[model samples]
Target chain A: MFPVFEIFGKQIGVYGIMAAVGFVACFLVGRLLIRRYDIDIYDFALTMIAAGIGMAIGASLLYAATNYRYLFYGFSHFYEIGWSGLWMCVKTALDGFVFYGGFIGAAIGILIYTKCAKDVKAHRDHLLDIYAVLVPLFHGFGRVGCFFGGCCYGIESPFGFTVHNNHLNPAINDVNRFPVQLLESGCNLLIFLLLLVLFKKHIMEKRLIYLYLLIYPIVRFSDEFLRGDGIRGSLFGLSTSQWVSIILFIFALVMLPIKTKKLKAQSAQAAESDAD
Target chain B: MEQQQGKKGFAIASLVLGIVACVISWWGLVLGIIGIICAVIGLILAIQAQKSYKAIGQKNGVATAGLVLSIIGLILSIIGTIACGIVCAAGTAIANDSRIANQLLDQISSSVN
Candidate 1:
């Protein structure tokens, strides 16, 4: 798969280009979607910046966790390993990222933003509603980036892409891979369309995030089976992402009912007080 | 409103920083990183300026331009960083793996023949 292109005498990553494209698309769509809400556009933009920073930190930390042995060895033998060797260990430990880590980090980032920016917090439900709509749309483009970048590849199969010249992940080279990235991208786009329809019709109101959490995890859980990248550690015979998906699915299932119950209790309390 | 007018200095600073970032991003890795930092600051300033206008239900042309330019600078700086990092990492991998070097060389020689 082609990952890089020559631009202005520099080798620009296709992944970055796709990311930029995704952000622009999200910004335009989000602008339209938020018109119904009282939230400011800059507040939304600032929240996204927080999410981006959080994603970077979380992904790096998870990657380091995956290579803990290397990090330990690097630190323990600091004298013998020398500066270059230590740097090598550190670099190898932190070079890659886990998508699940980034996803969780982004959730925390948004939560933190709402807490700090009280004005934005007042419109929390509306903010989350728009976020739920935009996540899948942006994710679809990211998967496309993964497809071209030859990362997160599908399992080996006869009737699929025979990727070569992928120097970064040489495991992908000269293999007929199943193109799971593109498949997931397509699935994400379909989910995005469904969410968009729901948003446009104002069908789910503030519950769109729950709907997304329910649907996307099922999709992710099933798709994890098709992914060939085995670097992501598994626990209890299930890949990390699959386990995360299951946990998220169950979390949503549990939280939705509790959230509904709380809202109902609050409204009932307000009614009783008003009557007095 | 007064609040919107009060943010004019921020909009101007954002525009200036964004312009500087865009110019320096093309140079190399270190400059690219610095450019990205500048772009980020510019973006924040622009957002603050725009938020003031938006709060009062007004639009500011300068804030819009700053936002647009800062985004462009960020993208450019990111591209430069990606390109440099890729070249470095791939180069190191190639140096260590003889099979990869052989494969690449074979391809080149085959094409030449």
Candidate 2:
């Protein structure tokens, strides 16, 4: 019902609009990072444009795939399947946006673009450091978009934070859902601010990105419990994302020590070479 | 010179093949295997060309193109595989439901008669 919005014969949805708003916010934040850090990646706007195109394509593809039944059969076979059929499919896929899919897609896009540039490979360390911070800032915008679209609604709660009858979908009708999306958006905003503060103090580098890798998965895993409509099914008695989070958390922890050792060794070598 | 061009041609051909595989079929196990091949070759070429570009004090636009194309191709193929998974899951669900429904209806009819 809250699917389409028409203005001057042009149609849009809260999902798409909020996504765009998120992108704009990300662009502005990226611009701020550029000025603060003296990053010399192409003009900020061009980078934003390229990233925007990549995220848009990747997000829509993931959404369509995750909800393939709704996207193809439900929407296309309306005459044969009827409204109920389509509704079921839509409800099935409307639980939330797939974050892993978006993360992987955007990472590939940024890595390719950066590697292709003439100077980027030479400045790989600095470029990566800057990107580490930018990722969370941009991700914060996406969580906000998720909040407005009401896709990742929360489960029932006695707390007053529950959202009732969002009207975005029938499946979540009259339930006091947890507002999990809002919680995520808030956490991401805090993470973004923390990254900003760390970057200002110059205490962040590759380590900062590692922190994000640790923090986001933990947040997502905890929030997974509150999600009412999405893929909450257990795999080995744990939700899929929670399991993934556990795996990723361990991976990040293992990598942290290795990364720190590598950095130290490199710095020592540089110092010896400089003395020579 | 011709061999290098041929190699570049081969890489480009694979990249295009991968893209089409991703766009049309969008989901299949085989597409991912092929996509991996395309991405690997493309990545190698891109890195090699980048080294050559540095040696010559210039940029390698062709190699960059290969990298970008291969990356997009890889992403699309991966997406296609995921789509295939969702399709399989939905199909299985519907099939199971129909089977259960028919069984229940048969049991009820037999009992009533």
The i-RMS of every model, in angstroms, reads 8.8, 12.0
Task: Kindly report the docking quality category of candidate 2.
Answer: incorrect
**True-structure Cα RMSD, model 2:** 10.4
Residue A4 lDDT, candidate 2, scale 0-100? 37
- Per-residue CA lDDT of model 1 for B56-109, tens digit only, reads 778888888998899999888766654211322322234235575445434433
| Real contacts recovered, all predictions | 0.18, 0.00
Q: How close is candidate 2 to the true structure, as a TM-score?
A: 0.61
Off by over 4 Å in 1: A269-276, B1-4, B27-34, B53-62, B82-113
What is the Å distance of residue A171 in model 2 from its true position? Answer: 1.4
lDDT of 2 by residue, A225-247 (tens): 78775443345656656876888
Q: State residue A257's C-alpha deviation in candidate 1, in Å.
A: 0.7
The C-alpha RMSD in Å for every predicted model, in order, reads 6.1, 10.4
Per-residue C-alpha lDDT of model 2 across residues B42-97, encoded as one tens digit per residue: 54455545454555566555666765675566444433332211222222122235
Off by over 4 Å in 2: A1-4, A35-37, A41-96, A160-168, B1-113
- Kindly list the per-residue Cα lDDT of model 1 for residues A1-276, writing each as its tens digit: 778877767777777677767878988998888788856778888877777667667866765676565576567766765676676667656666666677677777778888898768877777777888888888898788777777787888886899777776677788898999898999999999999999899887777888898999999989888988655667787877888888889988998888778768878999999999
Q: List DockQ, one per candidate, in order.
A: 0.17, 0.04
Output the worst ten-in-a-row residue range by lDDT, candidate 1 chain A.
A65-74
